[model samples]
Target: MATQHDERAAPVPCALTPREERRSDLVDALRDSASVGLGAFPMGVAFGVLVVHSGLEWWWASTFSGVIFAGSLEFLFLGLVLAAAPLASIAVTAFAVNVRHVFYALSFPLHRVRGRLGKAYSTFALTDEAYAVTAGGAGRTFSSRRILGIQAFVHLYWAGGATAGALLGSALPAEVRGLEFAVTALFTVLAIDAVRAGRDVPTPVLALGCALAGRLALPGQMLPAALALFTACLLARYAWTRYTRTPYARTRRGGDHA
Candidate 1:
């Protein structure tokens, strides 16, 4: 009788339904992405304004933001497209500009995202802001739903901002001078935040050195050259660190056994 009473009084587990889970995930995503969206939306607006000022149709802004979905690259790509840059040059430029994403992929939580379509979209949507948000310590344990929701919200913010800017560009000044600086400002903020989070001095020092070297060696092509040099240096450092750690780990284990 006592056992029966105990069982009757025990609370039942209350699991969320699928719909509720999705709704909760969306709300959490909105909250997590709010800060990033604040910056991205304005940068995107800047891109759209530039697109219209450059004499392209307003729809082109949405097309680039939605299709390319790369904030920095889209800005550069607009110039290349307007200049009628050769396909080969454009291809090379795109690779050089985005090579850093390869490193980003090494640490991004791609495994947490499920479904082939979901993974594909997530990959396509992987921006600096997304990486910064999801790769942080607090974001390490984010669920698949939350990850997808973050990316989706950010994407919407960019696309929507671009559209709004394009539509409003005509009403604004004929010459918008500082709009182009938005991308640079956004990148600087992200870099600072990353440095703060990691507290890794060597990485930024190495990057600065690479940038200086690239500027000195190839002033016209500094960006790509700097990125290549930085990547090589990072790979070498990773290899050396791993090689050195293995021996110490083995030695520690041996001493423990002895």
Candidate 2:
């Protein structure tokens, strides 16, 4: 009876220690970010190659990768740097190019992460790839450590790839044909991927429509104009959804109660 009572009282399930739990979370994060690293690393290498071919110092590849850390904007910055575009133009252009990040914040798992610094870094490091990967991990219930680990891993992949490519590019011929087209190709691929994700269709539609209108209306200022138009449309959509949905929901609830 004593032996049976002891057996029955013993825990049936084993629990992971804190260290083991952390290790498991980190492994999961790494696995989740694996695809992102693959995509980012190769493109980063291309960016570094382009930077070197553009006659900029090799260190600029790693520098921009670490500081600006924005893939598309970094590509655009190469041209802007070479052309010596005015600071104001650069600022406005960068904002227009990257304004879509504002939308990513709406659904990002930022609230799950702890610590002000961790949250801040996650926000700063939030790229399209990171957002996509994290969104997919919504089912996994990502922990703070996992989220930070994924971001850090992606950041390393980009920065390390750029540094490596810069070293390799320095040894290659300066007149590399078609290297400059990398940015265009990257954006095209990104757009296609966004469509395929099937998250929302109207955003891309609004972007295309606004871009076309901007091109026709403001030839030299298409980017800024299109961005402005796109932003306005998004705001309008938000307002319509918020204001229109709430009243309808309330009315339906009231009628049901009545």
Best by lDDT: 1
Worst 10-residue lDDT window, candidate 2: 1-10
- lDDT (Cα) of model 2: 0.79
lDDT of 2 by residue, 101-122 (tens): 8777766889888999999899
What is the total number of backbone clashes in candidate 1? 0
Instruction: Report the poorest 10 consecutive residues by lDDT, candidate 1.
Output: 1-10
How far off is residue 251 in model 2, in Å? 15
TM-score of each: 0.75, 0.67
| Candidate 2 deviant stretches above 4 angstroms | 1-13, 137-140, 172-258
What lDDT is reached at residue 64 by model 1? 95
Per-residue lDDT tens digits for candidate 1, residues 1-258, read 234434334333596655667789899999988878878887788888889989999999999999888887888999999999999988887887777787777778988999999999999999887897888665778889899999999999998889888989878666445655555665677678778888889999999999999999999778768877998998788667656664435445333432
Q: Identify the runs in model 1 with alpha carbons over 4 angstroms from their true place.
A: 1-15, 173-201, 215-224, 239-258
